[model samples]
Target: MSLVPTVHLPDDLAAALTRRLAATAPTEASAQVDRLIENYRGATPTAAPVLRDAGDAAAYAAYRMPATYAAARSALAELRARTGAWTPRAHLDLGGGTGAARWAVADTWPGESGPRGTVLDWSAAALDLGRALAADASAPSVRATTWTRAPLSGAPELPAADLVTVSYVLGELTPGDRASLVDAAAGAARAGGVVLVAEPGTPEGYARVIAARGRLVAAGFRVLAPCPHSGPCPVTGTDWCHFAARVPRSALHRQVKGGTLPYEDEKFSYVAAVRPDGAGTPPAPAANRVVRHPQTRKGQVLLDLCAAAGDLTRTTVTKRHGPLYRAARDARWGAPWPPDDQPDGVPDSGGPDREGAV
Candidate 1:
């Protein structure tokens, strides 16, 4: 079975985002959707100004919420699996647009006791929508999440929590601002807490994540997920490592995008780190991270792995490799692989070389 946790929004939250969607006139809603995406894609130092109007906010909810929710859930799934958690009692959702992170967390850990949290964002309208959705949640802990309106950079204060997530917010800030935000989020994480950061999967996005990862380590945090080691990154050049999650489009989403595909693949890059000192022991580091989706052929499988040596290695397994080949065939993106020398026990080159034939 797939280990990734599925993202299922509470019924009321979905209803809140879509409740007003049907009232929109197609042409006008379409234009709002276009502008929202354009502005967000090119955004720097701001993402809420364009979403001020209610229609635009609704359109954005239709356009981005599902994908963002899926990405957050996927990142958190990887983080929890690699580093066991004490079961967070509280969360701080930094720039959690429409409170997607909160929803994802609730779904990821739907235990008897849910997590109470806070959502901080610059947009009042976005918060309003979030509050409306949250009000529908049956769990008191989730419904009680506080929404704070404040600047993302140089903010006076942030909530204290067991988990802090800065999701889909880095794209709106300058490089320096992104770094500053990471620092702030790191500080907000209570000792022994976990901090998760996620961004688009573009090369530029990867650069932002890489820079933040370096800074987080410098700040004395332990790197987790999407990276198996604490040293410098291994993937380089045009081959940036990212993972993809499929998000099923809502009816409103289909209308807004003017597409028929039921789902869209959201490619994202993320980092989950912890304040290692007081943080409880983490799971033993995996031997390698399957950075890319495995490619399977008739009797062979090609895998791109980020090994513990901090380098990307392309290792191919053929039927002759026996059990290793079977495991490689089933490995998905963001999963881990065991350490095995090049077929016949060859030392791993760690260079950009073709996977040796099985």
Candidate 2:
């Protein structure tokens, strides 16, 4: 018996997908279809080894929540606008979770000219959810094609495509696994292909984004979004850059959390990298101005208020001293004094001024 029960697709979606499958089969598409079927058959409701609880249907549902899908759609739209007139015939969605990204792609790029996608994830339950969602969409008569029971560690040889999407999956992997996945995705992109990677907004998540950025850059990928490529992270390197978005949570999520509104606040870092015909080197960082500080007094330590908009502030250190350690670590003062007494009225200058010394 399978750990997860068989997933049933909505009649309309399933029928449409079957019709589309018939058109692509017999020679080239047969093998792909068969592989997908076999994988789905082997996938049980039970979770994979990597997840915390393979058998917890509620947990699986939360994992495949709809908020993620909406975000993926928004990200894809942003990518399409930036990448120009490139259209995809096939799509590979790594760590797709519930196949929300796949369904979003189908819905956004519908019709005969729209692309076909392969939803890849380690969880069979998640894949099952993806199939159901794809079938539910009002897309053209096309098979909601998918392959389950396939782990990212041993992903099958994938067909090349114009676009590839890997959203909200890198954080789960160890550093080594993250690197390997990126290398594989980059290698799989055809000439003039684009890859979109999205993750939660957190300091660690941003670090992963940076790592991905480095790997993609080294592999000759050009960044299309998020300007000022090289600089101190806006979040002070404490968290990733992210925003809040509204989306429907899955059935499992509702059952587990007992909430109806599927909206979520996710912190994410994303990048759309493309292999251009003749891409140039990344731009250099901009220059900033420097300012000097005034002299210190017996009771007052000079502080460089230029950076703080010329507001001389004082902070006391020892119990008997006026202020210390503002300009430098080794700074000390005998007592407290006003800011005007210091040279240039700037703080932290080392000049000797004994007049009105504390």
Candidate 3:
């Protein structure tokens, strides 16, 4: 006879069970777990892979995973050291799925008499995980508060905070949503307050981070880390700066996904924006000439109107220059509107639109 080993839930799971079960009888909780197991057993094998949900069993399991917490702690430490401020009276974790950011923040500020934190996410499941982590840390009294409301576009009308963090959440938003989140984060930071925004290190992810950086800069935040005041992201288009993180798999997580081992791969990037004490107004945009790409049959050019910064860079494949240039231009500035009726422009040899000069 062959024996299959039963997988045990991670410590965080046990803690969550203990907390939630505290309100209910152990027998009842066990029965509920059994029922959940049975439900999973009957689930169709062909079911689609679970999508990432804000507050779900999978998200909770992911938060409990060590890698996620470690990365968050590293980021927090870096931000704190750069800002030269130790104790924070209040902290806010935006889109803090499963309270991973909350756990990380509490751990980072251990034994510090000050600093209460609030974990805000759309999922009740995530809030439960946040509560569980807090309870495990044995500081539930000091580290209390969880917000289930979605973040607003402008400043959030919640409690004020000295340190605010938005981690691994911006990439999940649309462009407009990203802008709104950035604005809200800036507003949440009090004078001399710090706002840290982090995301995965993919092209799309970095692009979103860059967009947030722009908004933060406009709102009067200073860049604390990562050399180079401001420039194009260094990653190639296809490859991004992401890492593999291990997170414990729970029944809730497994029910949503199936087994676990290869944990989540989180691509992350972070920026700390701070408002200086007694600072009057934000600095003006950099006064650098927008570097323009030399006119080439196949090259991309990006123009920054505010800074008058432009650059023309060669692309991997010359064939993509037209589309890339058009995209770059649209991204930096609004669509170019040419005056109607002009000299007969030479048709683009490569395509219908390529021949015209803008």
**Mind giving the per-residue lDDT tens digits that candidate 2 earns over 230-337?**
322333324344433444443333443454564344435666677665545422211110112234455454432111221223333222332322422232121112
Candidate 3 positional error at 350, Å: 51
Candidate 2 Cα errors over 4 Å, as ranges: 1-59, 62-64, 154-157, 228-236, 248-255, 259-262, 278-358
**lDDT-better candidate, 1 vs 2:** 1
TM-score (C-alpha, index-matched) for candidate 1: 0.87
User: Candidate 1 — what's its lDDT?
Assistant: 0.76
* Runs in model 1 lying further than 4 Å from the true structure: 1-13, 23-26, 278-280, 320-323, 338-358
Q: lDDT tens string, model 1, 1-358?
A: 4323235545766676677566777677788899887786674666345568667767777888888888888888877776555678889998875788998888777765888889988888888777777777766666888988877876437777888999888878777778888898888887777888888888987888888888888999887787878788876778676887877777777888888776788888988888775535654456678887678889888887787777777887778766667776777778767533323322255322345222
* Candidate 3 minimal-lDDT segment of 10 residues: 334-343
State each model's CA lDDT, in order: 0.76, 0.51, 0.51
TM-score of 3: 0.56
How many steric overlaps are in each model, in order?
0, 23, 13
For candidate 3, the per-residue lDDT at 35 reads 47
lDDT string for model 3 (49-90, tens) is 122232333333433334455456655655554444346678
